[model samples]
Target: MSFNWINESTAINLALALVITLISYIVIRRLITAITGRIASWSSRSSHGWTHYLGEIIGRTSRLLILLMAIQMGLYVIDLSPAWESRVSHIWFLVLALQFGLWMDAAVLLWARSALSSKSGHQRSQLTMTMISLMVRTALWAVVLLSVLANLGVDITAFVASLGIGGIAVALAVQNVLSDLFASLSIGIDKPFEQGDFVVFGDIAGSIEYIGLKTTRIRSLSGEQVICSNTQLLQQTIHNYKRMSERRVLFQFDISYRTPTEKVAEVAPLVKQIITSLEKTRFDRAHLLALESNALKFEVVYYVLSSDYNQYMDIQQSINMALLKELEQRQIKFGMPVRSLEFLEDVPVIQRASSDVDESRMVQK
Candidate 1:
């Protein structure tokens, strides 16, 4: 009938602390939920407002952190051994560190999403946002982990030093991979080419199909996929044909030298007329560029207002056919390779003596 198992004061104090802790937890939990809910409601009212970030952070608050706070408050009222207090303190620190890390992770993700969403006409690159979010979360968790270790009386100096050495080793082992990863990041940020862009780099001409972390996949003109390292791609010169607003075309042709000079001069004007008559074309100039041993060369320069290769080819084919027809009507001929050979009318001939005559002459001598 006598509760003598424990000290009366200690028992009473412990019971009171437990009751206070429970009451505090319920009250704090309800308060947090109410406040966060109200903020969320307010944010929802203003769809495009800065209060969304605040509401998000508040909503992400960890229930474990609230419980930890209640426990700490209750424990503060009880008497405990130094060892027990130390252990509890370390546990609290660990929880706090983990909770902070979670908050940071959430914040980073939300910020990334918001930034990407805000991009209207020019959307931010998804790959870049993903990389940024990953790095931020990783760094945050790393710091939190180190802080927890240090709080638990772990010697972080050696651990950090070892980590640095390990990092260096890892870097050296995967330097090329790291280089490509960074290059991919650069590509995302610099926007040298985007997905579905026609690009020529080195000897490869293709349309970018996928831009990845280590390599970019391209659909080659020859109907094959080309996988190129991002580092190598960045190192080479890239010709992004998709960015070209107009294409300049230079073409040359030859006419027979026997063509009348007056008619030969008409070649340039005829070409200009034909080119200017075509839609989406701007004729720059046409001239007799050179008189070679084989033919008279005419150089023509024009611009195609379209960047489409097929459109350019079609325009060029039409112009060529029209010019050919016109030349035929004018009795003009295209130059052809010709060669001539000359022969002497008369020539002296030398013949070798017979073997029998040579043998007889040698016998007589």
Candidate 2:
């Protein structure tokens, strides 16, 4: 639309630029408000979900930055010196980069907080979450700063190289600590085990007591606290007993060889019956696996339908107690050592000859 007020140029078109910039700023702000308000309304409809965070991220767009964007748009219609244009371009780059960094920072913080909050009883410490968030933000802002400096015609090659060397030195200085820190993060996110979980890794068996940024404290079976670095803990193959669905059990017992053949044959079926009568047991198979010199060895296999050690013990005890009673009812005797001769007093000494004639002379004959 042609208008008289459109081209009222003065002093590098400051008058027109100001008018345009003000109008643009008003329009953009209104648009942002309307859009963000709608998102907030939608968030309210839900049960305080991620939508609320979405609205906040969008709403956090700085008013000063928005004004600068509007000014950049206004400057598009004006004539300026090469030096001024370069300055304007640099400002634009810096603004956009800062805004991007802010957005990324918000998302990272939200993610870290939610990750910590979501894991119930996982023992992800506040310090861990803070350190993680700080490290990521530091990296992000460093990239943004470098980009801005490069845009302003500063030579960043030397700066980048120096940073690389410095970073290497720092990392090497704290390599062990860093390794444990990152491993702790892995544990928090990947969750091989949680607090109070019974875990066995290598030779260490314990219940997790605390998870820290550098180390994990565990209460061992012998009532001693075992402190292990997160790096060392994660390096080994872990057995999470707390997460075990079921337990496989195999046991062996022997019965006397003198027991009747029928009774020996009945052992397997009798053992199976006893195990089946107990709750939380899945009968597998029972068999007379081997015959010893003095006993018949029977092997029994089954599954405990629980991971609880006490429950398994209770079931085993019941099986053992019932076994002896049932065997007594069937008149079957448990295995015992074979008979052997013993002398109570010394006998008459006899000397053996090395030759046949001498042997006959030494003998009773």
Candidate 3:
């Protein structure tokens, strides 16, 4: 048996491909470094960190592109026979998919960085960003799949037509998920509640964290993350407390029945003044309500100009303390629970004892 060494055509092709690959790798790597350096130099360290990370991504992508080009060119140089055409097509398809995936990832990362830099007090914009990323990735994957089908010598147009029919059936089967997805879209557009906004819907109360395709995530007051279907959220009544500019407070108190009517008249204006004088609080009205059996019911109505719950509480406390001080100064006393008692001198037992004593006295006389 005679052993055949490397043929002239194969040797030449292999040597040329190796040289080209090495040169392409070196050139692409240097170019990536240069471009990334230029971009990073334009920003401060805080902002440059993302750019640096992006540079590494670019470098890797460039290397991949160079390798792909080298392989594609090397196939022609090596004179690949028609028998291997299907395998070559498959390889190209895979390489194309890989390239698309990498690009999609890079684009998503860039948009994420932009969203992170947005100063909207909350990451509300991230919902839009995420949706866009998902759509883009989906489109990329679809293209890759189509290419793969075509590379495998499948009739892509007919396949797509068949897929459209199947898609209808699938959509019908997953109508609930589709409905929620559309609801998520509505949430993004209508924006009844945004990320970090305190919202109450039905029995749920929480701050929104994530708005996904089918679900919305919330961080509850108990520090737990609550996942809710977007459809359910949309169908329910949503109360967004973040939009509240002012808060209304209605409360009741009690005054002693012994207090004079004139003193009751003085209490309203005094309480109003005390409330209005406090920061961020306005007294709407204070009225002596219906007289109970034991005390006069007083109702106080006020509005706090601030929406912050803590600030509202602070203002309320201040008004409460001022009211207490004013009541003390006016010598006004709060009412306590009381009951009334009546006594009758003509009771049966007393009458009986008195009659018996009188009879005994008369007998002694």
Candidate 4:
């Protein structure tokens, strides 16, 4: 058998082209890496979002893509068959499509992050931002996938129609879940309450731990988790204590009925003084509200300037203690539950006639 080797001219050309491609790849890759690093550093220092996003894209672009480009150019130096050339072109198209998709996905993420960060406290909700990011990424990838399919000469019309029908079926199957999901989105937008906010919805009072698509988990006051569907939660009246600017407190206490009318009258002014003496308290009104069967009821109304429950409790306690001390010093008494019983002086007693007759008979015998 006779063996034929490649021609010297072709062999030399291939070797030279390969060596130059390798050297160019190393040099170009390093240059790109260095430039991207510098750009990233500079963009990081700047507050402009677009610049930073551009830098991030540049930094994240795969070096292999650059190498592939170099190799494609190098292949031109060697004469290749039409079939091989067509294969290389397809390869380039695929790589470029994938790289473009990645870049677009990254851009969406970066923009979402920036938008979330720039929002005000009332406008920014973590779940909302996450959902927005997810939707944007999904849409971007869908477009990319369609482009890739088109590039590969795949007819996607029927595929897209089938996807729509499948999506409708899936949505119908998960309608309840979808309802809750939309409710969660509404909560994010309307902001009835956010994570970490203390809220009372229905009979459950708790701090929101997490807001998810279908369910919102709350850490209840009794140290248990309360998981409620977002749809159900939205249906209830939510008392968001976190948003309260001040707490208006109306409390009543009773003094003994034995207290003199003048002293009872003095009680209101005394309570008002006690409440007004405390910081962050606004005394609204104190009055001898009613005369009950057992005691005279006094009503006190005040506002705590702070939303902090602990702070309000502390102020209320201080006022209560001071009021108690004042009443004690003035020889006043607090009302207590009392009961009364009456007794008759005299009552008739009846003896059994059978016992009397038996005694008489026994005596006679």
What are the lDDT figures for the candidates, one per model? 0.89, 0.88, 0.79, 0.85
Which candidate's lDDT is highest?
1
User: Alpha-carbon error at 270 in model 2, in Å?
Assistant: 0.8
Cα TM-score per model = 0.79, 0.81, 0.60, 0.69
User: Which ranges in model 2 have alpha carbons more than 4 Å from their true place?
Assistant: 1-21, 40-54, 71-82, 113-135, 342-365
Which consecutive 10 residues in model 1 have the weakest lDDT in total?
A: 344-353
Count residue pairs with overlapping backbones in model 2.
0
Candidate 1 residue-wise lDDT, 143-240, digit = tens: 99889988988899999999999999999999999999999899988889988899998889999999999999999999999999999899898999
Which is the better candidate, 2 or 4, if ranked by lDDT? 2
What TM-score should be assigned to candidate 4? 0.69
- 170-274 per-residue lDDT for model 4 (tens digits): 999999999998898898888888889999977899999999999999999999999999999998989999999999999999999888888877888898889
Candidate 2 lDDT tens digits, 1-365: 75656554644488778889999999999998998999999998888778878887877788899999999989977887898998898889988999999888998888778867785524565656787799999999999999999888899999999989998999999999999989988887678888889999878899999988899999999999999999989988999999999999999998998888877888899999999999999999999999888889899999999999999999999999999899999999889888879874534332222355577776956
Kindly report which residue pairs in candidate 3 clash with one another: none
TM-score of 2: 0.81
Between candidates 1 and 4, the one scoring higher on lDDT is: 1
TM-score of 3: 0.60
Candidate 3 structure quality by residue, lDDT tens digits, 167-263 = 9999999999999988887787677887778998877888988888889999998989999999988888898999999999998888898888898
Stretches off by above 4 angstroms in model 1 are 1-3, 6-8, 45-50, 79-92, 114-128, 338-365
